[model samples]
Target: MSMANLSFLNVLKLDNNQFTGQIPLDLRRLDRIKEFSVTNNRLTGQVPALKKGSVSVDSYAGNLGLCGYPLPLCEGSTKKARTGVIIGAALGSAAIVALVVGGGMMFVMRKVVRKKKEDPDENKWARSIKGTKKIKEG
Candidate 1:
């Protein structure tokens, strides 16, 4: 039953009920309502404004579709924005990793070329043998 027509209601506790849709707008006209709650329901849209500091915010918990003061502002594109940020970060990390790896490979290739130029006549095995012979003779 809609509680908006109840004129003399002082305290209303409709928690844990399967009430769907929005709280009736006419409820704001109730002057004597001191405490009200509709928690754990499928209610959606802006909650009907009540007297300031009259009811605790906890009384409105578990209604996922509700949005207003004390609850976060409703946002439909939040998931999409979050996904875009994650994809951008992943692409950025991949680019940085690729550049670092390519630079390292270039450095290693340059060192190999320098080593080859310094010893054109001797292969790697021959250089090691020659160095060992020199050490033994000394």
Candidate 2:
């Protein structure tokens, strides 16, 4: 069987192939591409910066010679966990804040309801007396 030639705009998967060379800089020129990968190829070069930005690290995986953004550095693989922790922390904080604010709002609402229940007639009379308090006080 022969490999069929196909035109791809958003994806160009050639994973686990024997293709060798620097990944083309022009690969970044595919502006509409949101995901691009050449994992498990013999590609060699400084890694390409996405001109369009923000593809997943799995997009660069399993290649021997590719380096930068998503690769293990002298420091080691950090990006994946860092992103997950950041997103998790942010969501956790937001949940806490929502609970606090919602509780506070419920507390305020409960107070108003209790006050109304305690003195339903006071509200009506209080309104009447507001504009005439000085007159009544005199």
TM-score of each: 0.47, 0.41
Expressed as tens digits, the lDDT of each residue in 7-101 for candidate 2 is 23655567788778877665655655656677777787656666554666687677667766666452333677688999999999999999999
1-138: candidate 1 lDDT, tens digit per residue: 666677788888899998999877678777788888888998887666665338667878888888755567557547777999999999999999999999999999999998879887656678566546443654
C-alpha lDDT of candidate 2 relative to the true structure: 0.69
Write down the lDDT that model 1 would get: 0.79
Candidate 1 Cα RMSD (Å): 13.4
Backbone clashes in model 1, listed as residue pairs: none
Task: Quantify all predictions' global Cα lDDT against the true fold.
Answer: 0.79, 0.69
